[model samples]
Target: MIRAADPSDAVAIARIYNQAITDGSYATCDLKPVSAESRIDWLKQHQPPYPVFVWENQLGEVIGYSALSPFSIRPSYRSIAEVAIYVDQAQRRGIVGGRLLIHLMKTAKKLGFRALVALILEKNQSSFEAAIGLGFQRVAYLPEVAKMKQQWEGVIWVQKDLTASSQ
Candidate 1:
């Protein structure tokens, strides 16, 4: 099931995120594991229009999660959001991540966001293709701007128009 996240979901969400951070890190630029306390604080930053959602099992365990965050510090960019998704390593082969992403897009639209963007690692082909298939198009690329595991890597920014009504 998918639902808006609350403070109690922090630990489970943190575990899923930390797995992605340590496993290969193609999923996120953040390298180290974050504490639930930190995630609680992070969760507070998201208000009405921008929110975080978690994919939970019948037992209420969070297996995956996604969110829309402020794209920039400037108010002019408030209409744009940076989207992210993460799935537990144990549950990866399923459609969990895609479902969470779709849910985020829907929520973003309902809240009147103008656009949703994803800054994806160039090497993460699955995420890139998935975002493209979901109607996001590449807008820009930062070449070798970050180094992971001693190797330089690039990132691509893809965005979807949220103004259009969904089919």
Candidate 2:
């Protein structure tokens, strides 16, 4: 089942997120792992309007997670939010990330977001495919914007216009 993430879910969430970070996943470009305590702080930053959600197993273990975060710190950008989803490496075949993205899209619309954007690694075709499958369109590409593994990598920004769905 999927539900809103709380401070207590930090440990499991951190473990899953760290794995993606270590594996150079498309969610982020970070190369270091962070502690649960830090994750708690991050969770705290996302309050009611933009909350984080997690998928749990029957045993109550967090296996995947997603969130809708403010796309920009400026007040004028409140209608746009960023999407984030991470699934445990051991649970990839479960399609957890796809489920999480679907959840985030609904949540974004419910929270009055006009659009949801995902900044994905250009080289990660699977992620791009997943986002497109979930209704996001690749709107822009920034080439050689970040360096990782001694090579310049790019980011593709995918966005879903929420208003289009209601009309």
Candidate 3:
């Protein structure tokens, strides 16, 4: 099941996100593990059109999470949003991330977003393929834009035009 995230889900969200951060999975650029308290503050920033959603198991554990965040502060970019997803390492091979992302996409469209963008690491082919399978198109590539552990890496920018999809 997937639902809007609340303050209480911070801990589980942090755990799943930290897994990506620590495992060198190239899934995220965050270098440090986030605290649950800080995640609560992050959760507070996401409201209405831009909100965080968590995937919960039958036992009510948060196994994955996704969110639509403001793509930019400029008024001209208000119609676009950036999407992010993180799932527990144990659930990475499953459909958790895909489901969470699909949910986020539908919510973004219904909330008036014209496009949703995902910035994926160049080495994270699984995530790239998943995003493409969900209808996101690669729009740009930034080479050697990120330095992770003294090594340079690139980022792939993918976008989904919500207007082309059925409401």
Candidate 4:
């Protein structure tokens, strides 16, 4: 099940995200594992139009999470939002990530966002392809944007139009 994340869900969210950081999957550029306390603050940043959601298991554990953040601070870009998703290492290559993304898209449209964008690491083919499968179009490719583990890696930018007609 997916629901709005509260402070109580911080630990599990951090655990899932930290696993991705340590697994070297290049799912995220964040180099350090975030603390539960820090995640609480991060959750606070996502309010109203922007939100943080968690995918919970039958046992009530947070197995995955997704968030919509400001794509750019420029006032002209207010209609565009950036997306980020992370699934538990144990649940990789499963339906969890895709479902979270789909949910985010719906929520973004409802929140008055005209478009949603995702910046995926070039090396994470599965994630990049998943976004494409969900109707996001490749907008651009940023070369050597991040240096992970002493090696430079590129990024792929994908965008999904959220206008009513897109549905």
Candidate 5:
């Protein structure tokens, strides 16, 4: 089941996210795992207007999560949102990420968002393809945008229109 994340699920979310960070699929450098308290504080600090959702398995575990944050602080950019999706390493290739992203897009549209964007590491082809499969277009490629482990990596910015008229 896919639903809004709760404070209690922070621990599970942090565990999954930490796995990604450690595996180098998420962050290129090693980082300490985030605590449940921090996750709960984040949930409390940003709710509704900015949404965070989770996908739970039959066992009621958080297997994946997705979120939409303001694209820019300017008032005119209110209709635009930047999105991020993450799934448990064990849950990858099981469609969890796809499902969570679709939910995020639907929710974003319902929230009156005009555009949804995802910034992906150029080397992460799976993520790039997934975004395209979900209707996002490759809008830009930022060369050597970030350096990780002494290697420079590019960033691909993908976008999808969420307006009814866009369909």
Candidate 6:
């Protein structure tokens, strides 16, 4: 099931996130995993309009999370949002990521967002394919945008319009 994330879900989310960082799929730093306290602080700071959603299993464990943050600081960009999704390694191919993404898209539209953008690492084929399957179009690609673990990585920018009301 997918639902709004609570402070209690922080540890699980942090664990999965840290695992992604370690696995090289996400290309993040090797810092210590974020604590629940920090997650609570983050949740408190974001306020109402912005939200974070999590995918949960039958055991109530958090398998993945997706969030929508402001796409740009300009006032004219207020209707756009940047989306991020991360899933537990074990749940990679189980559709958890897809469900979380779909939920984010629905929630973003309901919250009056006009568009949703995804910044994806080039090597992450699964994520790119998932976004394409969800109707997101690749609008740009930045070659050698980031250097991770001594290797250069590219980034793909994908977008989807959410202005059309859902039937």
Of candidate 4, the 10-residue stretch with the lowest lDDT total is 158-167
**For model 5, how does the per-residue alpha-carbon lDDT over 1-167 read when each residue is reduced to its tens digit?**
99888888889877877886678784323356777788888778666689889999999888898889888889999899999888989889888999998899888888989999988888888899999999999999999978776788898999999875754
Relative to the unseen true structure, what is the Cα RMSD of model 2?
A: 1.3
Off by over 4 Å in 6: 27-33, 165-167
Pairs with steric clashes in candidate 2: none
RMSD of 1: 1.2
The number of residue pairs in model 6 that clash at the backbone is 0
Clashes in each model (backbone N, CA, C under 3 Å)?
0, 0, 0, 0, 0, 0
Query: In model 1, which regions exceed 4 Å deviation?
Result: none
TM-score of each: 0.95, 0.95, 0.97, 0.97, 0.92, 0.91
Worst 10 residues of 1 by lDDT: 158-167
Q: How do all the candidates rank in terms of lDDT, highest first?
A: 4, 3, 1, 2, 5, 6
Per-residue CA lDDT of model 6 for 1-167, tens digit only, reads: 88888788888877877887778785243345676678777666556577988888999888898888888889999998988888989889878888888999888888988899988888888889999999899999999977777887888999998866551
lDDT (0 to 1) per candidate: 0.89, 0.89, 0.93, 0.94, 0.84, 0.83
Question: Better model by lDDT, 4 or 5?
Answer: 4
lDDT of 3: 0.93
Encode model 3's per-residue lDDT on 45-110: one tens digit a residue. 997788999999999999999999999999999999999999999999799999999999899988
User: How far does residue 136 in candidate 4 sit from its true spot (Å)?
Assistant: 0.4
**Looking at model 2, which ten-residue stretch has the lowest summed lDDT?**
23-32
